[model samples]
Structures are given as C-alpha cells and as structure tokens.
Target: MWVPAKFRSKVLAEPVRRPQLIEHSSDKNKNKNLETRPQQHPILSAQQHSISQELHGKKPAVFKMPVDYSKWDALELSDDSDVEVHPNVDKRSFIRAKQNQIHQQRFERKNKIETYKYERVVNDGLLKRINALLAALESHSADADKRSPDELMFMAIMETAGDSPNEAPPPPPAGVHTQEKEQPTYSKMMAALVDQVKAKVDEDKPENRFAAYVEDVKSHKAKVEDLQRQLLEELDSLEKEEGRKITSENIHTGFDSSHVTKGKAEDKSTGEAKKSTQKAQTVEVLNPQALGKPLLTKKSDGQQSSGADADADEPMGGDDDDEDEVEASELGKKFASIKAGDYRTCLEFISQHPEVVAEKETDGLLVLAFNSAIDGAYELARQCVHQALLLQYCRALGRDGVRMFFKRITTPGHQAQKVFFDDVNSTFARIKSRAKEIEKQRAQEEAEGTGGVEQIQLHAVDPNTTINIQIPPENSSDPAEIKAKELFNAFPPGLQRALESGSLDEVNKVLGKMSVEEAEEIVAQLSEGGMLSVEEQIIDATTEEGQKALKEFEEQEKAAQQEQAAEQAALSKYSDDPE
Candidate 1:
C-alpha cells in the first residue's frame, strides 16, 4: 500500500533497531555469474556483436580474423571489472506508475475544486456578516441622535421586559377603546340605536296636521286649474270678439261681408277661365318655337283659306285708317278716364302693344310720357326714368332703342313723334344746361353734408326698399327690378351725393327735385315703350344660368355616351373573339 509522504516519513524516521537485509535467491546468483563470464577477444567480440546486432538494433563492426581456429583463440582475454546489472523491471513499473499518476492527478483536481468551493462559501458568509454589521451600525448611528425620552423609555422597557429568558413576556397594555366607558359587553348600544332609529322613522310619519295641509294644497291646485280654465275661456271669447270687430271694420263703403264673398267667387271663376285660356294659348305658341321647326308651312292652302274666311266674316263698315285712328283715340281716352271697369281692358291693350310710349323734356327735366295708366302706371314710369337716368349719367345704355321700344308697349296710344321728337329736341338743350347747374349745387351740398364716407350708400343693399317711388310688389314686377338697378346706377354722382346728404325726405328734393311731370313722364315713357328684342333678351337672360347649366350637363352626357360606346366596342371585340 502507498502511504502519504508525511506518514511514510514518520514511520521511516522511527527506524527499526537493525536494518532489514533482503535475501537474494539462486536466480540472482546465476545472473551474477553470467555477468562475470570472461570477455571475448576483439574478433570474438565483433562476432558476438554481429550476432546480437538484431537485438541491439545496430550495424556490426568488421573484425580481422586469424586463419587458424584454435581452442586458445576461443578463450578470450578477460579484465576483472566490478559491474552491476539491474534487472529489467520497467514493464511492471510502467503500469503501476501510470495508474498512480492518474490517481494523483484526479486527487489533486478533486481537492482543488473542494478547496475553491469551501473558500467561496467562506467569502459569501464573510460578506453577509459584513453587510449585517454595516446595517446595524448605520441604524444605531441614525437612532443615536434622534431618540426622544419617551421613545428611549419605551425601547428600554421593551428590552427589559422582552429580554427576560426565564419568564413569559408580560401581556401588552390594552388598546384604547373608541366607545365611552358606559358601553358594556352586553351592548345596549344596539338597542339604544334601534330606539333612536325608531324615533327618527316616527318623525318622518305624516301627522294629522300634515295630512290636512296636503289636502288643502290639493284643493288649492284644483281651484287654480278651474280658474285657469275660466281665464282661457274668457281670453278665447275676447279674441273672437276682436276678430269680429276687425272683420266689420274692414268692409268697404258699399260692400258688405256677404257681397265680398260673392265678389271673390266671381273673381275666382273669371280668373280661372282666363288662366286656362292663357295657358292653352301660351302652350300653342311655345310648342312650335320650342321645336324650332314650323308646325305647319306658313303658305299652306288650308291656313290661307281659313284666314280669308275669317277676314270676310268681319264687319268692314269703317275705313281701315279711320277705324285704327278711332281705336287709338279710344284707348287714349280710356287712360284719361280710368275706371275699375275699363282698367283691365286698358292694361290688356297696353301689355299687348307697348310701342306708343313717348320721351319728352320739359322745364329742365326729362319726361317719359305714357298714354295710359292701368292700376300701376306710376311704377312703370319710375322704372323708365331710372333707365333714362342711367343712360344719361352712366353712359351705359349706349343709345339702345330697347328701353324706348318697351315703353311703346306699356303705354299704348302715346304719340311717339310729337312727344319724343318734337318736345325732346326743343327742350333738351335747356334741360342739359339746367342739369349742369343742378349738378354743381348738389356737389356743393354734398361737400357740406355731415355724414362721412362710411355712411354713404354706394350700392343698393335691399333693392326693393331703396327707391323713393312706391311701386307695389305686383306692379314693380321682374322688369322693374332691372330698371331700378339701372337707374340707381345712372344717377349723376352729384345727385346721388345730394340724395345721400338726406334730401331723401322728399322725392322732389332729390331725384324728383328736377320737376313734376319731368320725372314722372320719363318713367311713363319707359313703361309704355316696347322692344321685341328687349322682351326676348329678358326671357333669355332670365333662363341663362339654368340654360348654361343644362347645356353643360347635356355635353357631359354626350361625352359619357361616347366613352361608353368606345368601351363597348373594345368589350365587344373580346366577346366576339372569345380567345
């Protein structure tokens, strides 16, 4: 068995009294004798070397040899040398050495690992202990300065009492109780609380007095409802009585309520008949125009024959020129003697033929003279005056005959040559000179006016209310609005300036200030004038926005159709080929 170096050393140090001598066997004796055998001569040595060369792994050296081989030659020279030969124990030693080396290396590795682990454990424990010490020191340092007497006392008491190893720790002092001392374990608190709750609940109960009060309030609410009903009835009766009074008061001098209703019925029937006939005639007229192709040839034999027959049936008692002159005179007379009965007839005539209106100048003022006044002649006259003003001042109308021509239709029987050509030429020069003086006066007034630029009404905000003339909503009509705008624009800046300066209180003080018939007559002339193109343009412009929109829409539709056709063509090719 192998022992550790230290133990072996200890055993060896206490030596045996006598050294033990190992006994040698006869094989070792034989080995010794063989090793001491006589040496061979050089030649023999060489020969032996040759023979053993294979075992020793070397080339044999050449040796010279005598020719005669004798027994003496065989005997080699010998030298007495004390030589020791150790036995070949290498194999046995190699196995044991390898095993011992492996064991030693394994032992060393295991011991080193165990030692390292042990050191790590020791280091960790040391570090933990150091941390604990540090924490304790910090806590002590923190508490050393701030501990109060009461805190210290408490700490000391706890330490003294708890630190006793022999006795059980004393029970802690009882916690402070929230309830008063009168509170008992049996807890009458619950019963007392119950009684208090019961009292509170009882207080909420309705008493006799409360019931009576509720009943009284209900009765009062009922009475209020009754009063409200009576008040509403009285209000309704008063409203009805007032309505009756209004109705009675609105009656005309001759007509009563019954007559008014009857008149209204008659008017409604007549109006309906007129409306239907008018619509039918309008449709007949418009249909051919819309088609843009004649419905029948103008020279058709059937129409010519019918026309001849109709003309032949008429009473041709008066000369044609004389009859025409009398008709015109009658129309003119109708205007001078305007009555409710003839009003409609005159208006229809004027509306149908608007070419006889006149333009005249008198007393330093332009006059638009109309031959007739249906209910709304004043309004039409104002419109014409406004247009003329715009033409004179703004220079926008540019000698357009459209305005004058429309006037002819609105004021039938007006003598054009006498009123326009004769009076206008004779009086225009005087009016122009006077107008220039008026312009200067107006500018002088405006410069002295109190209002500044901010207050000036340069443009009409509400076109309806801007005019001084009282044009009824119906009489003013579509054309009136356009005329008003034109005239408002035409006002000489000086006149407008005067008007803006507050001469608005009186018509004559501003636009009407020129002269009486001058302004009114100019308006009347325009209201009566007729221009076929003006009527057409008005109709056209009225529908311009919608027409433009519709044209664009139609163009889009055509383009869409074209695109669809192209797409269909391409798709059809694909369908036809199917490949």
Candidate 2:
C-alpha cells in the first residue's frame, strides 16, 4: 500500500502521552531550549587538536561531530530478530570488538569437553552408580533437619554399597594407610551459622526471660524502697541530733512522699545517731589542745603576770575534767616549743588569744625550773614559768606569785628542791648579761643592715668558756689596763705568754687546768681588762651556727674585695683620662 508523505510524517512523529499546558514562563523557556543544540565539547576539540599535533606536528581542524549510531543500529536490526538489539537506545562501547574472537572459540571448544566428560563417566559407570545409589539413599533417607553429620555420612556410604552389612574395606597396601579427608560441607555450614549467631544463652532463656525480667525489676524496686527508707530515717535522726527537734508530725515532712520508704532508715555512724547538737550544753570540743591555747599561757621570762594575785595554780576551764588534760597538753607543747626556741609559734598562739597569758600555768615550781635548767635554755624557761606563776596566783594566797614560786623551790625537806634553786641566782646573773649583749648586737645589726661594722659572735654563758667583758682603756692608765696587768701577773708564765700573743687555744687549754669557778674569775678579770679581740668567738665550723657564721664572713670578704677593686678601677680610670 502506498502511504502519503503527510500520513507517514504524522505516524513517525513522537507519540503525545500528556496534554500540553497553556504557554507560560516555563513553557516559553522550554521552547527556547529547542532553538539550538550545543556543539560537541570544546575540550574534545582541544584534545583532538593536541593529538594531531603530536602525530603530524601541527594543529588540525576542530573535531567532527560524532555520528549517533543508535537510530542507525535500530533501523538496521529492526527486522533481524536473531540479533539482540536495543530499540531507540544509544549505548557507548567501552571495549572494541576483540580481533582474535577467543570467547566464541572457547565456547565451541567446550563442546568436545562435554562429550568427553560424558564418555568418561559412562566408561567408568560413575553416573549409573551414582544415580542408583542416590535412588537407594532417597528411599531410606531420614529427615534432613533431624539427621546428624555421622548418620548422614553413614547413610551415604550404605547407599553407595547397596546396604551391604558384611562388606569390609580391603587392607591398605603395606605402608599406604587411608586417612579421612576434611568435609567442606560441615565447615561451610558451621561458618554460615557462626556468622548469623552469637553465643549468649545466659541472657537468652527463651521460656523464662520475661519472668526473670519481672522478678529482677521487683527486687530492684524493693532495694530502692529500702534504701530510701534508710536515708529518711537517717535524715530524721540527724535533724534531731543537730538540735532541730523532730516531732512525730514533722518526721517525714522534709522528704518527698513519692520517694519516702515505709520503714525507718538506719543511721550513719551509730545505727541512727541523732544530731549531736542536742547535747549543746556538754561543750564537746574535738581537740582540747586548741581550747587550752585560748585560755591561759605565758611568755618565757621572769616577767610578772598581770594577774599575779589571781589563781594561777588551778587549771582553766574547770567546769569539766577535760580542762585539766587540755591545760597539761597545752603547757607541755608550749614548754617544748619554747625550749626548742620556736618563739614564732608561741607568739602566734598568744596572738590568737592574748588573754591566755594571765591564765593558770602550773602549781609546781620544780617542774618549770628543772626543765628550763636541763634544756640549756635556763633564762628563757625561768622567765616564762615565772610569768605563768603570776597568772596562776590565788588571790587568797596574799603574796607575790614570784615569791610563792621561790618558796616552793627552796622548801627545806626535799634535797632536789635545793638542787634547782642553788644555781638559779648565779646562772640568772650571767645569762642576763649575755642576753643583754645578744639583744644589743641583734638590734644594731637590724638597724645598720649589711653596711654595719663586723659583728661580734657571743659565746654561750657556760662554766667552761670565758666571758669577754672588755671595757675601753681610758687614758692608757685606765682601770681596765691595771686590772688586765694584775690578771696577767697572777697567771702562769705559759698562760701569760699565750695571752700576750692572743693564742685563744692556749688560753682555753690553760683554763681547762683550773676549776670552772677559778677559770671563770680569771677570764672575767682578763675580759674586764680589755684583752680579748671582737672576732675570736670559739666557733666549731662543723656546727650549723659555725657554718652560718663562716658563710656570712665569706660574703663580707667578697663584698670588701669588690669594693677595693671598684676603687682601684676608678683610680686607674682617672689617671688614664686626666679628667
């Protein structure tokens, strides 16, 4: 039949699946897109130009448009059903057709393989035997799901031999024994199962899981309720103990009803201890040591207490027995700290409560006096305890605290009492003098700083050492010079020469030969005569005091050296410049 070109054009036109919309902005934009098709990519043009240059050494024409093979292919294969082709579709070729066509050759080559395989199976009777065995196994096969690995394998073997019970395997050739090979089927199946599952039977009880969860929840709730009750009871008891009265009505008033337990809470510390504040009148001080510090303390001096006529013998805080223990401990610490020369801490304690200075110290004089004498801080201890005596004095005693303290020391019946008192007067005088000298030196050092004249280290006031009380020689015929000459004449010839030459070690040796009193009298005479130098303090360099003194001396020497060098440098510079 001959078709009109108009009819053919209408038939070949794209089929209209949807109705057209009225021409709006979007429709106009769609029409504009149909006006022109873009050219092949410019990058492809550049690539072809570069390729041409690389081959022919020059740029060539722009890339020619690639022909669309889709429509052509569809047209060519339209009636050829045998050729599998995509209609009206374009597909890009990733790989070019293989020139050798090995795939088709390989396919044709498998034809002889199948034939040979069939012949081999038939010749060996493998296929027939396998099929017959399979039929027999299927007839007697157990359910696949219930069969174990061994049972299944045994069935397989039985089926292969037609269920022969008495057929035994032939003995292995002399040295060649048969061994079982691994079964890949079990391994693959187990691997698959392992991947899909996790072993968690403890948590995975299938039947009682929900019941266990319910029981656990009930137990937890009970535990929480019990804990809540305990907390509430504790809080109630604590409130009562702390002086906040707990009445029946207000027992659980502060706690939330929702969280409150039905039973009482156990107490912390005492199985429901009440607030300790209830015993407010008891005055429970944790450390009476601190309490004693604020009550009555004294400085280490013979200084009179402000309350000398007051009851200084009795312990403070007498309202309780703990006061006695506390006072003793405080006094003990004070004595130790003072003996150790830790005046800083003693001053701090006084600063906290200055009123402690006028409080009871101790009743016995021998205690403070003996301790002071033994600890090598005789003057300081005596002074402190004397002050304490004044503070601890009873108004009814009708006497000075110091006098009363002395009376206690010199009581006739006890020999030990005399021992403590006998040395007090003599030791006091020397220590007082030495203390004055030390105080003067310390004050001068503080006032002058490092720029002051060299310091004189004072020897400790003891029986063995000499006390240098050098007085300035007045008019060369001074009393000091006369006294020194007399002392010199009195000494042995060896001592006289050693003294004249200022050999301190020789003088010490000479002193050691005489009794302490005789040595002291001679040294005193020499000292009053202005014989000793300022720098000759007996220093054991191995001792801490000696080390400190040596260090100071070294620093002073270095300073002097620096000053001299500076002066020399100034003089040299002046000479060089004439300025």
Candidate 3:
C-alpha cells in the first residue's frame, strides 16, 4: 500500500529526536556558564542534509524516525490491494466479455432460425405430397361417376395439415359442411364448388345496374332493326329501278308475234323436186322456228308467168335469209347484255365487301358464305376427298375392287396418294376428338348459361374457319361412313339443319321440335344436294315464268284495244246524230 501525498506532511510532522554533539573549537567556547549554542548550519540545509544522510544510510539516526516526503515527490500512491496502476482500463477484457455475450445471442438466434427452417421444410413437404395425392385422386375421379371430390380434397388438406408441424389445420369456410368420411368423385367436387359459388353469389349484392342493362339491350335491338330496314329498302329501290328500265325498253321491241310468219317461203321448183327424189326419212328438215308444214309452192297456170318471174328472182331471195341471221345475232347480243348486267350486279355486291369475297379468290364464292373464315381450307379439302371417295366406292362394283383401288391409292410414289391412309385416319381421329371436345365445351358453356348455336354460325358462314372435324376418305380401308356418323352424332340436329339450309328460321323450328342430332342430319342433306342444287338454281333463275305472265298481260291489252275500236265504230255508224 502507498500513502497519499496529502498525508505525507502529517507523517513528517511526527515527534522525532535529533542527536546532540559537543565540539571544542580552537577559538570558540569562551565561557563555561554561557550555554553553548549548538554549532548549527542553516536550518533548512541541515534538514535537507539529514534527509539525504538518512536516505544514503550515513546518519546514526533512530529506526523510528519520520520519513520526510519533501524530497520524495516522484512516486505515485494507491490504497486498495486489488487496484493496480493500469495505463487505461483493461478494454481487451471488456471487449472479450461483450463478444462472448454477442456470440451467445447469435447461437440462440441460429437455433431459432434453424428450427423455423426445419418446420417450414417439413410443412412444405407434407403440403406437396398432399397436393400430388389430391391431383392423382382428381385424375381418377374424373372418370368416376359414382363419387365426388370435395370430401377427398378436404380430407387430404386436413390430413396433410395435421401431419405438418408449422401449420394448424383449417376448418371449412363458414356455411360449408364436410361430407361423411368417404372418397369423393370429380363430379361431386364440381357440384360442391358450384354450390359454393352460388352461395357466394347470393351473399353479394349485384353491382350492375338493371336500368343500364335494359337500356343497352334496347339500344342494341334498335340498331339491329335499323340496319335490317335500311338493307331491305336498298334492295327494293334497286329492284324498282331495274323493273322500270326493263318495262320502258320492252314497249318498242319488235319481236315477231307468230312463229308461222317467221318461216322462210319455199320455191315452187324446190317443191316439185322434193316430190320427185326426196326420201321421207331423209327429208331436209325446216328450221326449228318454222312449223312442220311444207314450204309455200307457186300457183298452177294463171300465176305461172308470175311464178317464173318469182323463180327468176328466187336467187336474190337469199338476201332475205340474211335478215333472219341478223335478227338472231341481235337476240344473242341482247342476251349477252342481260347476262353482263346481272354479273355486274353480283360483282358490285362482292366488291363493296372485298374481305367477304376474299375466299372466292381461292375456292371461289361457291365454297364459302362469309369473308371472315379463311382458315377452313384443310377441312374443306378433307370433305372433298371424302365425298369423292364415297361416290367412287359406291360405283366400284365390288368390295375387292374397292379395296384394290384403295391399296393402289396408298402405294408409294403415287402422285395422288401423297396423303397416306394413315394420315387420313389420323385426321379423322383428330376430327373425332375435336368434335368430342367441342361437344364437351358446349355442354360446359350451357351449364354455365353462356352457350348457344354460335359455333354453328362459324361453320355455316365462314369457309375459312377450320373445322378440326374430319372423316376418312372413301377409298380408305377405314369405315368413313361410320366415322362420319359418329362425328355427326355429336352435334345437335337443330344445328345440323341450320347448316344444311340457308334458313335460320327453319333451323329454329327444327330445334323446337327435334334434338340437335336430328337437325344435323337434315343439314347433311344440304351437303349432298351440292352440284344438283347448283344446276337447279341456274335454271330456276332464267326460266320463263315472267315471260308467260307478260304474254297474258299483252293478250289482255290487245283484247281491250279491239273492244275500244269496235265501240268507236258503233258510235260513228249507229249513235243518234248530235242534231
């Protein structure tokens, strides 16, 4: 232990004795009675010397003397035994202690994180396994009509949640009840989902304004009506204009009234010659416009001279025949003019909407009804092949010959056999599959209350709309008719009827009375009517119904004219004079 510098004075002030020494100096000590003053030097110097002597162990001093701190100012002091004179506090020890604490905290944090990670991994793994199992169950349930899926899915989720450490199992949503423990089918799950959706919908207040919806529907109806009216009016105006021009032109047209008057007069010499050498069966027939009557002959005797003169001029009568040829040429020209006008009318309609007629550039207007469908080329080609093959097969005389023909068609390097039987079969399969898909899709749409005959419209009007539907070619070994029947069966009869006839009303009527498949059969008839229908269409348009009606009108006009003439003559001859 070391004492403080402030207490050094107290320690030095403690009572201490100094040794007395007598010395005889040669010139000093005069009187014995006088007290001999100790031979003293400077008091401060003496004290310092004594301290030095003490420090150097030169003085004969007592052992208990107070230590003088006046010259001992170089040393520092401390009181506590455990305390030491450090340069600074031991920062290294403090830093080490803090580091240890931090390390401990980190270890705890690491343990917690690892535990969380492990739980997460375990939970996630369980969820994944459950989801996989549910997916497999769903796949199996897709074909099972007897079971449902909601219970199984719920059980799966619950069991998976129970097995997992990180999550607590969820109860079903409020108002939902789980079925008794049993495996559920896909259909049941779907039904349950539908019920859940219905419940949700019921809970929601409709945000759509009913008044706005009504207004929109009304507006749409008005627009459709206006468009239809405008188109009809335009058609009527065109017909009236064409009719006026035709009627005005017909009044001055000078066609012959009688076929008899149009026949060429025969010469008397030719008549006499016909009587002599003409074979009855080989007789020169008159022109079609001439009645089957024989040609006019010359008079017997009184008119003989005139006949001779006429015979002389008969060679010049050939000029008269030129008139007939000229008239025929004029009629042909007239027919051509009429045909050109009709063609222009059609072309103008097509040109006004070039997009609709675009398909015509490839397949011509005969194949497509609408401009929008350009992609159905593949389907159309397949249909053509099927139709051709079927017709050929029917006329092939025997099955063996048909098979041989089919084999020949399938042979390699045959230019026409580029599309193999397998390809055709595959295409047919694709079509069948596609048709089934479409059927399912339509059914789903209907279930959702969103389906209609919209798909049939594409097939009817859009030639470019590819129908994945296909049938094997007739020459194929496959039963194409059977395939066709299967495909046809998938569609509603009403849809089929609509496709066959251009009339939607007929389709609607058929739908009202029959199934969709039945209607489709009716429509298939339209496909069969193809070329024959085309021929009939051409003949019907140009037939003479109008001409017959016009003839009756003309006869009536002629009779009225004759009656007026008779009335005027009667008035002039028999009526009383205006006296």
TM-score of every model versus the real structure: 0.13, 0.15, 0.12
lDDT of 2: 0.44
RMSD to the true structure for each prediction, in A, is 54.1, 44.1, 49.5
- The residue-by-residue lDDT of candidate 1 on 488-578, one tens digit each, is 3333333333434543443233332233333444344323331001111212335778577557656877988999999999988888675
Backbone clashes for every candidate come to 33, 17, 18
Candidate number of the best lDDT: 2
Across residues 1-579, which tens digit of lDDT does each residue of candidate 3 receive?
A: 677999988877985655434536753556453343333334447766667557555564455868797644432222213443456767556556655774565455444444434334433443344444444444444434444334434443444344435342233332233343433432343344335533443455344322222233344335445654564565455444434322222356476575422212343365456655544323232222121111212222222211112223221111112111111121122221232213333333333322322212223221221111234344543443343232233234353454454455546678545544445456445654555666688779989999753212213222222222232233435464555544433333333334355554544443444333433443464344331122211122255975665565568779889999999998889667776
lDDT for model 1 comes to 0.38
Candidates' C-alpha lDDT: 0.38, 0.44, 0.40
Residue 397 error, candidate 3, Å:
99
Candidate 3 clash figure, as a count? 18
lDDT of 2 by residue, 195-236 (tens): 222222235654533233333334433544565556556545
Model 2 residue 233 CA deviation (Å) reads 48
Could you tell me which 10 consecutive residues in candidate 2 have the lowest summed lDDT?
302-311
Off by over 4 Å in 2: 1-410, 426-431, 451-562, 566-579
